[model samples]
Target: MRNKSIKKLNNKMNSKKVIVTFLILVCTIFNIGAQNITPDSKVLYKKVNGDSLYLHLFKPEISKKPTAAIVFFFGGGWVGGNPKQFYQQSKYFASRGILAISAEYRVKNTHGTSPFECVEDGKSAIRWVRENAKELNIDPNKIVASGGSAGGHVALTTALIKGLENVDENLSVSSVPNAVVAYNPVSDTTLKGYGSKKVVGRETEISPTDQVKKDMPPMLIFHGTKDKTVPFENAERFTRLMKEAGNDCELVAVDNMGHGFFNGDFFRKGTGNKYFNLTAYKTDVFLEKLCYLKEKPTLAENIKQVSCIGDSNTEATYPKFLQEKLGENYQVKNFGKGGATLIEGTNHPYFKKKEYKNSLKFTPDIVLIMFGTNDANVKWCLDKTRKTKFIGTPQEEFKSQYIKLINTYKRKNENAEIYVLTPLPIYEHAKSRDPEIKKRIKHLYDWVIPIIREIAEEQNVKLIDVNKLMKKAYKYTVDGIHLNQKGYKILAKKIAKEIK
Candidate 1:
């Protein structure tokens, strides 16, 4: 009886071992799959004082070519911050078919450096990605610069500020990003803003607000209205200035929230996750607008190409904001030049320029024509010496040139849809800068605009009244002549609505 019991116990032990081994195999397979979905790789992007700054990359299981990328910087007031702060974001973007990276920069805690060094390292990280784009399967033009708080300032400076690049790095490789996503960024580092004292006399050089220009990339900023650290007014002011410079900037305001409200991992629990998720969702929407995501939030498919042609207002104007409003499916190109006119004998004729040829080459599905603003110039239009050279009056010549240009496009592509846009209204304040321009403005309002409308009717093409829209948002105009970023956005919305 004793021998039988001992054999039975050994059998039970053997059964338990088999079950344990099977469970271990299942868990191992699960873990492996998870790792394959989001795998981490590290590479040294910069080194300073014997310390190696590494970029922690998170790559997704891509089925096809992965062309989009996002590089994130962590925020800690430029004093101390860890790359882990953006680990969750990196993984999230990687899963969405983006090559996500969490970059390490010289911080006060580790490198004993200030904000200037941090900015330098940020630029280096972008250059590294752009330089190695082909090898990493990333689109150099589609790379996005994103960060939170002080790190947000670095990202903005990388795209805006001209100098302060790393001396040891490759200067040929540009560090500027195509777009920016900032969270509660210290964008205005002026005397009234945070980090001003830290940057010292270089405040204006480092401040993204102070560095605003006409051609900076589209930016999306998230800020809390109640936040005291960075203050909500800073974001408002920065975006205002950006628009004033004719650049696209979108601000998402979180009501009654404070600083550091966007960290998803920190707010993983409870209602805090709601705020984090909201920001992420909005970010996805913004990226989708830029055509960075493969699957958009909306159901539109089969992208359409759009070409915008005209003067300075058309150069970096509403097409950019239009691109954002139309989402990824509609590709918008700007073929505008400053001081370009429809009349051939003018100083800068639109038809004679290379942009016209390029626009024809694009063979776009939709064409937006916004001329007449510069054509109405007194020196170019009503000049006594040049006026008689044309077949008729300046207004009559404008109509004829516009009709010929329209016919040229229609003949080239019968299927192409052309939309004529009325020139934006010029404010008196802008006209005051040049007396001749002010006189020209009267001619535009009285003669040029009516003829444009008449031509649209005669050609049987769609007409967009941009002047009416700009009149409503006249406050967004910086110099009375050109629409600021906000005005462009408003105009773009009107154009986009017509297109849809």
Candidate 2:
């Protein structure tokens, strides 16, 4: 009896320990994911037949007038994919002062709806947004619809096809959007093009391009030359037809790129963009065109467009000073965000946010790059957690991606000249992160400086060792992290001297 009692007590103790350990793990996970919760978004629904259709509407943050809205549809080949895939893009648009609505329609698997029914529902969503524009603080006249793949098909079809009398009468409004931005879309549904397979009788109705006519709103089409699913020529043909109809149209061909080019290169890196062959692709130049479509400058226009491309230092350090030095020419177009490596820029976040814009409006005649800092940091994790593939060891991958970035810029802009600046030295001041961080910085310089020399020798591109030059102007820097106005003046002058 005594031995049995002791065994039960020990078992109880182990159970308690297990519970405590599980609690600790749960707390740790919660801590890692503890971001500020965004306010609950407003959800609105419309009853269709006996069921209900839902739309997630994110109103503009600050606007005097009803903002231009987008009834966004997510891509799933008409059978699958979820509406939640648009969370980031929707929030981004809403944060940028645009009203965004991510709409949900019956999917083929879920509702057994035909492709035609999906298109009809897409049209109905646009009509709903327009009908309730005033109530939703949206501009009916300026509503724009956008999507990718099948979603792109929906956006383009709605904009290109004029009269959809079958659209829900209860909504009671025109389905036409003022603008359509289709990302790697099925421009010709007839499936008779370079990349399309015959799907006329099998899946979808006849090609929407066949139904094209005049009065379609301005269309912006983006496609990858290497896209096997959707032909690049389809985009070209659609743009041609729209132009022939006297409607405004523009197509941005992403060189060495492929299908679903939207987030593949722009949203996140290593998100299956390896097939894109983006080693020399200029994606941002195209995106900026969409943003500044009405305000695009002519080729002869000499606008002071400066690009500050680098890692964290570019974002946290040089931009504000560069802005002051150039006065008006400084647009603070820094391509680097935090923890971003060179590969990320060439393939993703930077390409989407910065480079896509440059493709459309103005290629930077002058680019200032200061990136080796992160590349050299040995403690840095080369592989992103979500992206299991190793981007590469610091030396091999960093050097290759940087070379690719320069080559890409050259390919995009014939007159483009990149001024590669070595990263600044780590400051002597630090509490805990000083010694190891500084050591890594030195390691980066060892790898990067020699590579820069080799690059200068091989290519016509210019290299500036800001580390050595800044030593002469050390007093101009703030915390040795960034440049003050005096430092920027000196840095710009040094760059100008190098260029001259």
Candidate 3:
């Protein structure tokens, strides 16, 4: 009776442990956020313990030469997680002209294995990719391993640990990845860190901190400072050890975020790209440094990209005619926010919008900037309650910001040709009854345009005096503020001459 009671007590304890593990692992994977992205193709990589494992490939449309590839492993505490967890990231890498893969690895609940097998499966997946590099049209030497949480541990073990090899496979092809990109990965797996109980006797053998050595592949890690599952200290320790051994390792500690903070959240769609897009951008920067992939899509050599930065005028007008005028040689992209200002303190600043980020991304060979018309919106520059003492003048901020905006573009691409255009003259604006435009129109004429000219001369950027060119063209404007098709065509001709 005593023996039976002891077994019953142990069984209850195991049941509760399973429940806790399930909750934590479920949050790590964030299965609900996984997108239904279909890979370009799926291939059977290996079979183990009567289960066949496959790889999800996100390949570019064309692979003329053997390009670099990145492989991703999903996190589930070595327990439960979907192969689709990294689909969003995989698709993005594919779009960037590289081969990307998300692998299926053994897990505790599904494969009836320990955490060690998860590491083994990660190695096997990389080995298979290397072995079939020619078939996949990827450079075998430049493979990158990436993952989050437990999957990150798996990825790191493939590069750090060597003993967990499958017996049947040929041992010649190296399984270690050329580089690593981890998102909140479990860097340590010993008694002092996470999953130590799961690994049991072989903790140090697979712990990345223990395996750090000289001349290892470069590593880039992103970890949330507030993560409890995988303590943030583990990341710090692993990086320190890596550098001590003369290896290159960088750790990006995300502030005040918890576990699974790197997962792609579909709900964060617009300007508030909390984590997903921001992390992806950082990931690309890391990969670009390692030569794994280019950060942006490759354009044909003959085509130069143009980024048009401005207000409602650039959005609704001249860009249409500018594209036609630039002809087949240039690809023009309009990044104009309707009510945006040069001054960031205003309610609608272009610097705070997604359009600004997108503008810098297209690899612009030429940048045309036009503002000042919208800075004339007197209300945007005001403090919440102007009834109180005046904070400062908008003109004071505009001069600095205009120079700052020009310098921003120059910093983005040193070789990029930048042009600063003056705002078109407002002869009579019927749609805009703003007291400033109707009354002192001098706000734009006297205060705004002169600042624009000063910015161009001070910054050494080329100047296009659009306000001077469109002086008497009021008949071609829709509301004397916005241009019609004919007005824009005339305006495009003037800008096109400067570009040529």
Q: lDDT of each model, Cα atoms only?
A: 0.77, 0.58, 0.76
Off by over 4 Å in 1: 1-39, 266-271, 297-500
**What CA RMSD would you report for each candidate?**
23.2, 15.9, 13.7
Residue 206 lDDT in candidate 1: 86
The digit string of per-residue lDDT tens for model 3 on 1-500 reads 12343343323322321122333222221212233467766777888979988888877546567888899999999998877778867866776768899999888888898888898999999998898776677899989999989999988888998688998987798899999989888888897789898888888888899888888889989999999899999999999999999999999998777898776533222211235555766777778887777645221213455888998889877876886777644557678988888766565688788888888755466889998887776675544543322245777677777787777777866878999899988865667556566533667877888888888888888999999888877888777578888898999988998888
Cα lDDT of model 1 by residue, 38-143, tens digit: 3266766777789888888876444346468899999999999888767756766765667888899998887899888888899999998898775566889999
Of models 1 and 3, which has the larger TM-score?
3
The local distance difference test score of model 3 is 0.76
Best by lDDT: 1
> Candidate 3, which segments miss by more than 4 Å at Cα?
1-35, 266-273, 295-500
> Candidate 3, TM-score vs. the true structure?
0.54
Query: Which 10 successive residues of model 2 have the least lDDT summed?
Result: 25-34
Model 2 over residues 153-221: C-alpha lDDT tens digits? 888877866554353465356887878877777777664552134244543343556767888877777
TM for every model, in the order presented, reads 0.52, 0.54, 0.54
